[model samples]
Target: MTVRVSRVRQHSVWASLVSDDAQALRGWLLQLGFAEDLLIPGERVDAIHHCQLDWPEGGRILLSSTGERPTPCRPGTASLHVVTADPDAVLARATSLDARVVREIVDQTDYPSRDFTVADPDGNHWTFATFAG
Candidate 1:
């Protein structure tokens, strides 16, 4: 069964990503606590035309496979910042997945937030922080 995003929470903006391996990217996002909202198949059995992953806290991301169609955006070149209540938990999950830690978690007194950065298998940098802004 496919999961649906909650109507209570509406998102006006969404981050978009292109992936060479859409399935693997989806798995990675799922492992990191993103819920699969939608997945549309492409021309090929294994190709994904589009996907929507909803973050537990808030917001959503749209992802598409790098296929025959030309896209201005390239895979592994996007950097996304996600705000979460628990960055430590996210860090632990990232470590369990053996994702590369691009930046160690640090407390920024100026911004008064805790954040860390990790690179997914596709090389996209994901930064999880306590500060929403």
Candidate 2:
């Protein structure tokens, strides 16, 4: 039998990242100003383990350290875009953490916003912007 439902409640969006060193990645995220309170911490059960950084608006970035080694995102492959009030301020914090800048802050002609991109320790691309989304 085919089950059908009318109307669904969209709850949250979760982004997961597999890291070779979850601890160091968590530290780097902390340096970028993601407070410890946002983290739910990790739990290991058998051969699986996972943790998450809860976003204020219901989204989350799940940081997992298990399974085979992960292959970092290739250039131009993918990027995580974060909308914030102040992109410059975020840039400063990232600078302090010595994160690699993939792109300097600039106003996009077409996008109608200011943003910057940086590569995390594991080579994942993250873009912080003032875009209202």
Candidate 3:
């Protein structure tokens, strides 16, 4: 089953980008109204709530983050989280595209979310999850 944004939004839904180039990445994200300070050089972002975006070329965007709840942009992030009712089906689709499954779908008793992870050809991380059923 194909998962949609609304499904994850039922609980706590959030997305972020952990990039190596936080400076250039932050600069690129700022153009779209992402918190420039949060992404600044040497900022203590580990615990802070920061918006992660894929928007480049600098444009206004609507993003969601704890710092800026209900962000100005839609639900879009460099790290993709796809909520699928049938995660196996979604995994098959990604596998067809040659996506690398880093983590197989399984129940995480410690965490509220049951999900798996994958890596795309570009090394972008994709997480597919669902609430424990």
Candidate 4:
């Protein structure tokens, strides 16, 4: 039987990021609760990993090569913006998982946003915040 594909239903985002070390980075992801990740066929720089804990809501990551030089994550390419009812609780979990504290949750006087940043195993940024300032 032949397989057919269509976009009428839905799709998930597979984000590609620059990585210098694949296994080391993936290990970090697993440690951060993204367990049982994987690397697809034919790759030299990095591997693709998945964390389906939230399934339809959470997305997977694709680790790509950056030659021999180190590269920072592409601005908006790899980010998971999550809205939480309790920002403090989320921040607690993130900090416990060794997430990078990009910004502390504070009352935004200008934009009405309260959020923080947490870096994943591969150093990809995942911002967990809410619009309620």
lDDT for model 4 comes to 0.55
TM-scores for every candidate against the unseen true structure: 0.88, 0.71, 0.40, 0.49
The Cα error of candidate 2 at residue 67, in Å, is: 1.7
- Best candidate according to lDDT: 1
Report the error of model 1 at residue 30, Å: 0.2
Residue 114 Cα positional deviation in candidate 4, in Å, after optimal superposition = 5.2
Cα lDDT listed for each candidate:
0.88, 0.68, 0.48, 0.55
Off by over 4 Å in 4: 1-11, 41-56, 65-90, 106-114, 120-123, 130-133
Identify the superior model by lDDT, candidate 3 or candidate 4.
Answer: 4
Worst 10 residues of 3 by lDDT: 55-64
- Backbone clashes, candidate 4: 0
Model 1 TM-score, all chains together:
0.88
Clashes of each: 0, 0, 5, 0
Q: C-alpha displacement of 17 in model 3, angstroms? A: 9.7
Winning candidate number (TM-score)? 1
Ranking by lDDT: 1, 2, 4, 3
> Which window of ten consecutive residues has the lowest lDDT sum in model 4?
48-57
Ranking by TM-score: 1, 2, 4, 3
Any residue pairs clashing in model 3, and if so which? Answer: 62-72, 62-73, 63-71, 63-72, 63-73
